[model samples]
Target: MNEQTVTRDERAGEEAADPNRLLPDEDPSSHDPDDARHWLEVYDELLDFKRKMLTIAEEALDGMRDKPARREVVDTDRRVLRAECDRFEKRLAFWRNRLAAARDGKGP
Candidate 1:
């Protein structure tokens, strides 16, 4: 989204409702629309993966009550995914702040 351009605020409860943007991002690529597009694609991929992980974890935990090893594996993998989600959320805030600053004439 460009600072000079108008951003939709009517349904702007979330970035998805704003037509001017896709998933928030950082890096020099933030200036390119494709960067945001690619970020969203990757985000969707990760989202789907996370859902699958949950289903797999549930299925694994439901089976083999005597097996405690699956819990360890599932917990570890879930933590990794959680860390990635946290990272992405922070990155999103970074990008959003950048946009706000730019719009306010406080950013390069």
Candidate 2:
């Protein structure tokens, strides 16, 4: 092929081999606003659940505190409830982190 023809072919090949040109990337944060909003809502719901669990745990402990005679039973129930509350609180924290990551355009 002539030098001009070879150059044109090489340019065409380079364009075809361009990865970004072939597969464009859409910003995760820009793909869907509704998706981000949905995640935020999920995080909020988890926070609400965590709050309710803590309240329940506090009530259980308060009840146990008032009754020394039934310490074993009350304490056991309180312990179980407190553990559950902790788990829910952790979940809330995780969701909050995920929401933050999404906002910052990072991984969830």
Candidate 3:
């Protein structure tokens, strides 16, 4: 949800109109992994939080990027952070996918 917008105009839709926004995607009466029904919501939040944090970090590093004194350091840090962010996104996506599959009637 960390869009490339210059500002945080899109509040990530964090505050759901429906308390249990994912409730529609889930069926509590089902004897499936409804117990793990919260997994998707949790994962989505985690990813959003992480993305926000990374955006802050990237912005900080970018501010340093223009300073000759910090260029070298920030350059390296930015690269490392981007790589780590990619890995983190992939890792979270895996679990999110599984949860989605389960919610959609596929096996967890």
Candidate 4:
């Protein structure tokens, strides 16, 4: 099971008032190799985007003395980049844990 499945199961359990169904089985390490590859690829893309955003933020800050409006735009982009970074960090951690589990012969 993936994150969505687990979330759905939790919601279903809450709606049904079933404590036993609250925790969903993930078994992440059992996912196919292709699926794992896809997850990694997405994580990499997020990281790349985060880097690009950071670069933009840096460039904007560097030009702050020359263009106040550019700084504002850069700040906004930085905030968005930070948010995306946080989101992607969570995803990366999840996949890393799954990978570790797989290596250890345990399902994530």
How do the residues 30-78 of candidate 4 rate in per-residue lDDT, one tens digit apiece?
5454555567677779678787877877776775776867766666557
Supply the global lDDT for candidate 4. 0.62
Report the lDDT tens digits of candidate 1 across residue range 1-108: 664344454234344323234343435445444554455456556656766775676677667475567667566655555555555555555555555655666744
Candidate 3 positional error at 54, Å = 3.7
Best by lDDT: 4
Best by TM-score: 4
RMSD of each: 15.4, 23.4, 11.0, 11.5
Each model's lDDT comes to 0.54, 0.53, 0.52, 0.62
For candidate 4, list the clashing residue pairs, or say none.
none
Question: What is the C-alpha lDDT profile of model 3 across 39-99, one tens digit per residue?
Answer: 4455466557657766776667655645774675555545544554454455445556665
User: What is the TM-score (0 to 1) of candidate 4?
Assistant: 0.58
TM-score of structure candidate 1: 0.47
Model 4, runs deviating above 4 Å: 1-33, 66-71
Model 3 TM-score (2 dp): 0.41
TM-score of 2: 0.41
Any idea how many clashes model 1 has?
0
Which is the better candidate, 1 or 2, if ranked by TM-score?
A: 1
